[model samples]
Target: MKKIMIFGAASAIAQETAKLFARDGENLFLVDMNIGRLEAVRDDILSRFKTKIEIYEMNALDFDKHQELFDKAIQTLGGLDAVLIAHGTLPDQIKTQEAQEMIIREFNINCVSVISLASIAANYFEKKKEGCIAVISSVAGDRGRQSNYIYGAAKGGVTTFLQGLRNRMTHSGVSVVTIKPGMVDTPMTAHLPKSPLFAKPGVVGKGIYKAMLSGKAVAYLPGYWRLIMFIIKMIPEWIFKKMKL
Candidate 1:
């Protein structure tokens, strides 16, 4: 059985991905800030899958403590075959603009914390010369839209960071996958109006699982988001800025 670690494991998307791994008989090391939700997810998985599962309570904002958590996960699993960083926050653009602290919080959670954990994992995986590293970025990173540029900027930084990581790991037998979902229907986006463009957590989770296993460099959930982002990225800035995103 494959040994895996999932950060932000209690999220709807993360839980769904965890289910697939559990069903496949893979051992999992899961963590989330919410202890109750983390335990609930662990219990639910135990109800169906006969696999080894471990849970830890942690807030990702504890950036300095990330290395400790990664080391602990490796110790718990004997060795980590793969790691998925799925934690991030969707910041309110208006609020962030009004409050400088909001922007800092957004970047800390979305970019800083994720990068910190990924850096630690990269070092470990580099030594082994074989492993998978995956992070959940977003299509928002593809372009800076007026609506959510702050959030987009953070994800964009993540995407760029992953690109460099992927490049460095190219010959090390490591796979760094960047997952950019369009509009995902998750608790993080509960206030947003849903439409056909929005994908369900389960759908995105399945895509993430498939991509991670395949070691694909980049994956867009529902697949179509790739084309959608392509067009958005291609538009001229002056012309694009005139239209509402």
Candidate 2:
């Protein structure tokens, strides 16, 4: 069985993805800020699949603890074949713009912490010479929109970092997959108005699972987001800037 570690195991999409791994009988090391939610997720997964699972409580912003957590996971799982970094926050755009503190904190949470963890994973996997590092970036990262540029910027940073990391690890037998999901229907987006563009967490979760296994350098969840983001990226700045996204 494949040994996997997920950093944001409590989130909806992460939970779904974890379940998929369990279905495959993979050993899992799940980490989240909330131990309660982590336990719930572990129990829920165990209800369906009998697989080895370990959960740890960790706030994504705890940069200093990242190495400790990773070491613990490695020790517990014996080894790791793949890792998924899924922890993030969808900060209120208006509120973030109003306060520099909010923007910095959110940015650190969404971007810096992810890069930190990925760096650790990259180093470990690079040494192993065979592993997968999959992260959940977003289609919002493709292009900045006035609606939520702060969050977009954070994810954008993640996407770019993954691109370079993927290149560096190409010959090392380490698969660095960047998963850019569109508007996913989770608690994160509950306050926003839903549209046909929105996708369910389970669908995105399944896509992430496949992407990691296939060693895709970049994957747009549900696939259509690829064309959609492509069209959006193709739009001229002059015309695009004048209209609402």
Tens digits of lDDT, candidate 1, 1-245: 99999999988898989999999999999999998998899999999989999999999998778989988998999999999999888888888988988889999999999899889999999999999999999999989988999999999999999999999997899999999988888999999989989999999999999999999999999899999889888999999999898
Residue 9's lDDT in candidate 2: 91
Instruction: List, residue by residue over 178-219, the lDDT tens digit for candidate 2.
Output: 999999999999998999989999999999999988999999
Error of 1 at 196 (Å): 0.8
List the candidate 1 regions with Cα displacement exceeding 4 Å.
none
Clash pairs, model 2 backbone: none
Candidate 2: deviation at residue 39, Å? 0.5
